[model samples]
Target: MNDNSEIQDVELAVSRWLRIGVIISAAVIVIGLILLFIHGGSGYPDDYYPHSLSEIYSGTITLKPYAVITTGLILLILTPVLRVAISIWVFVREGDKLYVIITSIVLAILIISFILGKA
Candidate 1:
């Protein structure tokens, strides 16, 4: 169709992806909370806290409530990262070097923040 229509479609797709990410994240969080209440937490703080992404994934696979919660939190945190990545792609496709650079910087900062926070 027209350029405007194509642009709107891309925007709509991006929005839809964001909405899906949030909804899935929220659902996971709710399920985790429900499991926590039902099972009384994956044996409390004295037992364990997932130390890494892999651990959380493993825990989630094992149906550990805390892991499920952490999985949800991680998903929520990564949603914006995903969005930024998508935006960068869109900017590149539109040949907007300025925005691509800006979005890349933002993404870099996000990664740095996470790294620094862990350290």
Candidate 2:
């Protein structure tokens, strides 16, 4: 195959992935809204601290169903959006793919940490 064909295939693949990501993102946003409504809204007061790290590590933290679900939904929506932006920036400038990959990984880890911490 010619270089042009290869490039076209890559572009098509990327487009397909982007479309899937968008659909998933929309679904996550809907779920997040549903959770926000079910959980009594997004803005929690300072006194609403639900868990201590020690208790969480000890597996004693009382996990609130709504909070965990809402947090996961929010992360699901945000992570892909962030990844796409970073990926586009990197791809456009022909920057290092490693940077994009590392950024995505770090964001994922942070999201997981936040979810676990809140739970």
Candidate 3:
């Protein structure tokens, strides 16, 4: 395949990957909602929900519905991060220095935002 074709293939793959990630995340959330409906999630108005990774993971490992929902939401949140990482890989492989640098910066900013968002 020519360079253009190869690039197209990569782009297509990236798009499909993102689509699949979103679909899977959505499905997970739907399942979690179903579980919540069946098992009944526990939370009073005064209680704050679990939003931290550790809390979510601990609950999820125990099959807690709300935590499962949080896991799905986290997966949805990670889709773009995965996309950016893939774009960086593609750019590097293509020797597109400008794009590689720009994508790298975007990735860095994304990481920083996640870190700061948690604080």
Candidate 4:
């Protein structure tokens, strides 16, 4: 197809995925909040919460409202990262090396920030 059409298609696909991700994240958070209200608490001590992926995963598996909320937050954080990674792929596929490089750097920095934030 024409370049403009192709670009529109890519944009639509990316936009759709981003929308889906955000909707799912918001739904999860809402569910978690409902559970929290039903249980009358976050299921964690006032000063304690899931601080790691594993902890969040375990807590979610156990149906902990706080963990579910944290999982939703993580999903929200990851949605943009997913979009950037997709942009890198689209750039590579279109033979746009400069954007590929720039997008890759952005992804790398995002990952580094996450790691450092955890540290």
Q: Which one is best on TM-score?
A: 4
For model 3, residues 1-61, the per-residue Cα lDDT tens digits are: 5988998999899999999999999998897888889886642134667878998888778
**What is candidate 4's lDDT per residue for 1-119, written digit by digit as tens?**
69999999999999998999999999989989998999899888886988889999999998899999889989998999999999999999999999999999999999999999988
Scored against the true structure, residue 61 in model 4 reaches a CA lDDT of 91
Q: Each model's TM-score, in the order given?
A: 0.88, 0.39, 0.91, 0.96
Candidate 2 yields a Cα-based lDDT of 0.56
Q: Local distance difference test, per candidate?
A: 0.89, 0.56, 0.88, 0.93
Worst 10 residues of 2 by lDDT: 55-64
User: Which pairs of residues have clashing backbones in candidate 4?
Assistant: none
lDDT of 1 by residue, 78-111 (tens): 9989999999999999999999999999999999
Query: Which residue pairs in candidate 1 collide?
Result: none
Stronger candidate by lDDT (1 vs 4) = 4
Error of 3 at 27 (Å): 1.5
The C-alpha RMSD in Å for every predicted model, in order, reads 1.9, 8.1, 1.9, 1.1
The residue-by-residue lDDT of candidate 2 on 1-119, one tens digit each, is 68578557666766666667667656655665665677664434544633544432232123333344444455556655565564556454556677767766776786787688766
Greater lDDT among 1 and 2 belongs to 1
